[model samples]
Target: MEYMKNYKHWLANVKEEERAELVALASDEKELKERFALPLAFGTAGMRGTLGLGTFRMNEYTVARATQGLADYIKEQGKDAMERGVVISYDTRRMSYEFAMKAARVLAANGVNAYLFENVRPVPICSFAVGYLGTFSGIMITASHNPKEYNGYKVYGSDGAQLSPEATARVVSFIEKRDYFGVPEATVDPSRENVMGKDNVKLCDHITVMGKSVDEAYFDRIAKLSLSPEAVAKEGGNLKIVYTPLHGSGYKPVTEILSRMQIPYNVVPEQAEPDPEFPTVKMPNPEMPDALTLGIKLAETLGSDVVIGTDPDADRMGVAVRTNKGEFVLLTGNQTGVLLMDYILRRHKEKGTLPQNAAVVKTIVTTSLAEKVAASYGAACYDVLTGFKFIGEKIDLFQKTGAHTFLFGYEESYGYLAGTHAKDKDAVVSTMLFAEMVCYYKSVGVSLYDRLQEIYKTLGYYAEKTISVYFKGLDGMEIMANKTKALRKVDIREIAGWKVASTVDFLAGEKTYSSGKKEKIDFPKSDVMKYFLEGGDWVAIRPSGTEPKLKLYVSASATTAEKAAEKAAALLDQMKGYVE
Candidate 1:
């Protein structure tokens, strides 16, 4: 009866186009249950769901409801907070612009100012704008590399990082108190309103436009992260690079940075423009090899030395470099992170800029090779949970304690951040850094692939892979929960012929050794299991927070690359069997 009450409200109020879908979906028992069972809450990421006509989906009503909650939270902070206002931006996804406008109108209706991007922008820009404009908070309308049928609203705190769990919980509490059908929103035509003009829409008097001013400020800050200007000056002109935005919001910033640095580069013509449908790729994420197929093809056509692809919203970057055999191969996220960490640290040491208290942060699931690279320069490395928000939280902690100087941060999912310029991952800075790193290596008469191999030889060869098993639709959640529950109880004594010395269940926040000794894990509780085996090999399992997939992570370290590969592959195979 409660679901029906909400359903009738939506069916009565929603636009004509969506009414048919809502009426049809109401008759499907399974879908209706899943959709009405619960509202979308903040996961490891923010509020993300498939696009459709339900409380579980991301639609105009859901966006408005979320924004109303945010507005309430902001107003509760005080008048000064409300006056400080909120910033809104969107990526190039279906309904992204509409959602952004809806958020602005909701905030406006609550007497809060809104600074909206005039055009599509990246995720980092939203983060940057939060601090740059001294806003109360920020919202980015994006699915962030999800499939075409998905959209998300990511909230950023005043410090320009994704809202911490504590903050998200607060917002969720406010949201839970509100009625979905009764969230207040002012009527505003985003297309008809200009930042400089008087508000034609109710409560939009405070809306301001952030355009070239914000973009320039963001670019200026990112450009300062370049560590190898001399290398760029020497080899920038001849460096043949091909870039693709995957039909998202990175084209302007990525190309602008390269051109400003005087680096010669070409864009994958077919993918240079923003297309909401993402006509060229199956998914917009660069982590998949196929996401860069068009970019790779363009690179080959231009005889480029490297190919780089940025996912939608431009936070994650993937690289494909030419090997010694003239074959271009995509580097895994671990490989890319390791290279960047080593390059950043090595260059910092050479320049005598290496802080004694310097530290690098990575997720527990990321490659352990980062620890070695950070340690080689006498720097400390810390591991957090998977989300980059934790990394940002650490940076914020360092800023207060002065115990550690933040050096770099990365995740295994092709996300990396070099400077504290923005708390979230910044592919704009990463693209600049990677470009400079490549140029520097080329100046020294070595290829990017060669440099990677050198690092592998110096620091014990490391091999890693993440295998994801996805379950779709209504039953997916149950299947994943049962599998993970069973996995938690499974008795795993050994893996890949090596004895399991210990196992850490993050969900339990405890680690138990083969000798029966137990210790508490001093981190956030997550449904992740990590097994430490003999001989520097390990395996981890966790469900993806943003998608309907269970992920298995394997990391193996050995004296030789071949041995490491063999060990990792065997462990992954065993884990796959368990997951399936």
Candidate 2:
């Protein structure tokens, strides 16, 4: 009944095109109900949803409401905070720029200065700008790697990381206090004046359009993160790397860095430009095989040794390398993480810059091979929750307490970060590092794939597979919730014939042993469950905090490669069966 009222409200006030779409949706009860039944949920990662005309969808109304809430929170921090303002950037998704400007306008209306990027930029740049400009907060309008019809609004703190849960909760509380339709809307007249000396200063009174000054500052810091500059200088001209931005925001920064480093590289021309429709790929995500098809084809044509693809906002990256067998093979996020981990450590040790307190951070679901590689070099490894915010949090914590020195951090979802230049996962930094990595290995007469095999040979062979089951519509949410709840009640002694060593419930913050003993897990509480099996293998299940899906991750390690792959596959199948 309330949704019916909300439907009428939108039908009366929305744009002509949106009004027509709403009228059509009204005829379909299921779709109408799904769109109007609830407001889009906001969490630590902010909000993501399909773009359309409803409270449940990502439209100007929803974006405006979120921006107003953030503005209100900023205003509450007092006049100085309001003056410091918020930085805003967007990727190349439909309405991304429009939504970003709308947010800037809202903040401007509230007497808060807004720093808006002149054009689309990667997420890490926005993060860096937050700290660089000493802004109160930052906003990024992107759906990340999602399909074309989707867009999202992510908020970042002054520390240049995604807002922590407590801060997000406060923002959500502010959001809930405001009416979606009643949020004030304002306007901004953007100009492209080349203010060289004042590139990042406010132009029209309240909103500033940032220019090359910010980019140069960000690039300078990213350049310092390179572990092997000599190797890059020696082999850069012969690296033969191919990169694709997937029609998003990575093109400029990614290409700029590659060229500046003097690395021989080619861009997949088809996806080099910014296209909100993402015409070349079904999904702009590099994690998918099809997303890299065009780039891989270009690499093959040019006899390139490696291919790299960045997602829409350039926060995540995917890679493929030419093998010694004269074939190209894709590397999973886990493989790439460990390869980089091993390389970073090896190079640091060789250079005598390897810190005695060096430590790497990864999510629990990531490959355990990183831990092995870290241990081999006497570097500590820490596992955090799934999001890169936790990794950023660890970085901040390490800086505060000096308990451990943060070296590198990554998640299994193609997100990686190095150095404190940017708090979030930075594909630009990762892309440059991978090029240097490739060039270094090539100088030694080996491909990245061969180096990966060598890593497996040195450490135990590790294989990991992540599967996601999407549950759509209203019923889907309930189904996912019930399944996770039921799974928490399960006390399985074995999975796919492997004996269980223990079960760790992140939600309860406890690990239960087969003998009925329980010990508290030191990590933060999350809606995740992990089953540790014999031989150091494990499986984890968690509902996606940002998407309408349940994710299952299975990681296995064995003395032999074939056995590890087999065990991982079997564990994944068994976990899928349980969820179904």
Candidate 3:
């Protein structure tokens, strides 16, 4: 009844065109309830959902309401915050540009300056612009790697990181008080040509359209992050690469960076341009193997040794390298993270640029091999919760205290950041670094695959597998919560014949050992569980923060790759049994 009431309210308030869409759904009870049973959740990462006319879907009204709440929060910070403005950027998703303009206009209506981009941009650049332009905050209109039906809103602090939990909570409090239809409309039409930055156009009082200058500064900063320019100079011309943006926002920037670095690369023409439909791929996510099929085929045609794919927002990257047998194999996120870490550290050490306080950060679900690699180079590795924001927070902390120099940060989901220029995972920089890495390895007569094998031989084989079980429909959230709750109550002693040495309940912020000793986990409480086995193996179970699924991650290490793979597979299978 409440959902029905909300649906009717939305249908009545929306425009004639939007009302038609809702009217069509009136007869579909399931669809109506799915779209109105709850308001699209606005967490620290912001909200994401289907594009439709409902309380739970993303639309002009929803974007406007969220922006109004953000404006209120900025107003709390005072007039200076209003003058500082907020950077706004979007990808090529359907209505992405419209949603971005809507947010900009809403912020402008609330008397907050909105520095909207002239055209589409990726997440990293938006994050970078917050700090680069001295903005009070930043907003990115993207769903990252989600399907085409979904779009999202991400808020960033002045530090260029996603808002902290406390900050997000404050913003949400203001957001909850606002009525979607009551938010004030834009006082001015800033979308006109005269409002743009080009042709010496005079910007409006509350809105500024940003262009090339921000990108130039961002590219310049990324160029300074190249550790092996000489290697790139030597092998760049010969080491051909195939890149595919998967019809998202990565095409221009990814190509421009490779050209700047003088790296020889080919782009899959079918996916070289921005298409909101993402026609060439089922999902615009690089983490999915099918997304790279075009890129890999082009690689084979061009005799390229590497294929790189960036997601819809270009915040995450995935790679497939040619092996010794002349076969292309996709590298898992864990493998890519470790390889990049090893390459960065080794190069820095060779050039004597490696800081004595160098450090790397990875999510708790990431491969433990990073620790072994970091230690081999006399660097420290730290684990954080499963978000790039935690990594960004650490980068901010390192800058304040001088405790450690942040070298690199990554999660197990193909997101990576190498430079402090952008506080979020940057596929632009990651693409640049990986291209340079391939060149660097080629200069030493080693393929990327061979180097990976060598690292395994030295550090011992490490295998990691991640599996997600979906829970669709309105009951998805409730089911996932109940499943995690049930798991928390069970004392899992062993999994796949591996003894559980300890179990960590992150929601309770406690790690209980088999010896009956309990230690507090010095991290924020989250609905997550991690088990440490007899060996250096680990398995983590947690509900996905952004999607309707429970994710299980397992990592197993052994003297050989086969054994490690087998162990990891078994552990993952057994872990699934516990949840399902």
Candidate 4:
């Protein structure tokens, strides 16, 4: 009844063209309820949903409401915040550009200055622009590797990181106080094209359309992150790489960095351009091997041994390397993170530039092998909660305390960041560094795959696997919560014949040992649980922040690769039963 009332209200207020869709849904009670049952959730990562005419959908009205809430929060921060403004960028998603312009208009309506990008840009550049322009905040309109039917809005603080939970809560509070229809309307017309490039063109008094200068500055800063110039100079030309953007926004920046480094690469022509439909892949996620099929095929034809794919927003990167048997295998995010960390540390040490307090950061779900690798080089490895925002927070802390030098940070979900140039995962920098990494290994008479094997052989084999279970529909959130609660109540003392040495309840913020000792976890409370096995392997279960899914991660280390893989597989299978 409430949903129907809300639906009627929207139907009455919206434009005549928008009313037809709402009126059509009148006969389908289920569809109407699904659309109007609740407002699209604005979480720590901001909002994401299918594009449609509904309270729970991503539309002009919802984008405006979210921006209005953000604008109100900025106003509370005072005149400096209003003067500082917000930087807006979008990916090549359906409605991405329109949503971006709508947000900029809403900000301008609220008297907040908006730095709007002239064209499509990726996530890292948007994050970089927030800091580069000293904006009060930033907004990126992208779903970041989700299906083409979906789009999202992500907010970043002036620190260039995703908004913290506390800040997000404040924004959500303001969002709840406003009615969807009552939010301020756009004050400026966004119809004019390429206004950002024109010298005298201003969309409004509060809007500034940004152009290539921000991009060049970003490129220049990340270019300096190159660690192995000599190796790149030697092998960059010979080491051919095949790259696919998967019809996302990565085409330009990824290729630009490679060209600047003189790394030889061929783009997968089919996926080289931006297409909102993302026609070539079922989903635009690089983490999925199917998305890289075109890239691998192109690599084979070009006699290239390495293939790289970046997601829709270009914040995450996926890599596949040729093996000794001349077969290309996709590298897991854990493997890539470990390999990159090892390469970075080894090079830093070789050049005598490795900081005495050097540190590497990883999500608790990431491979434990990173700690071993960091320890080998006398660097410390710190574990944070599941989000990159925590990693960014740690970087800020390290900068203030001078306790540790941040060298690299990564997660097991194909996201990585090596430099602080951007406070988030950067596929652009990752691509550049990985290309150089491939060259560096080649110069040493080894391939990326070969080097990965060598690292395993030297440091002990490590294997990791992640399983995600989707919970769809209206009851999805409740179901996920009940499942997590059920798991917490169960006494999971042993998993796959491995005794649980400790159980860490991140929500409880405590770790209970088998010996009856309990220790407080130094991180914020979250709905996650981890089990430390007696053999040093571990398992973690956490609900995804941005999507309606529960993820189970298993990590195993053994003296041999096969054994480690077998152990991880067994653990995952057993853990699957618990969640079910």
Global Cα RMSD, each model? 2.2, 1.8, 1.4, 1.3
Q: Which window of 10 residues has the lowest lDDT sum in candidate 3?
A: 193-202
Tens-digit lDDT string for candidate 4 (250-279) = 998999888988878899999998998989
324-348: candidate 2 lDDT, tens digit per residue = 7878888899998888888888889
All candidates' lDDT scores?
A: 0.88, 0.89, 0.91, 0.90
For model 3, name the residue pairs that clash.
none
Relative to the true structure, candidate 3 reaches a TM of 0.98
Winner on TM-score (1 vs 3) = 3
Q: Which stretches in model 4 have alpha-carbon errors above 4 Å?
A: 189-193, 196-201
TM-score, candidate number 2: 0.97
Error of 4 at 492 (Å): 1.1
Per-model TM-score versus the true fold:
0.96, 0.97, 0.98, 0.98
On a 0 to 100 scale, what is the lDDT of residue 238 in model 2? 73
Would you list the clashing residue pairs of candidate 2? none
- lDDT, candidate 3, at 115: 89
Give Cα distance to truth, residue 353, candidate 4, Å.
0.6
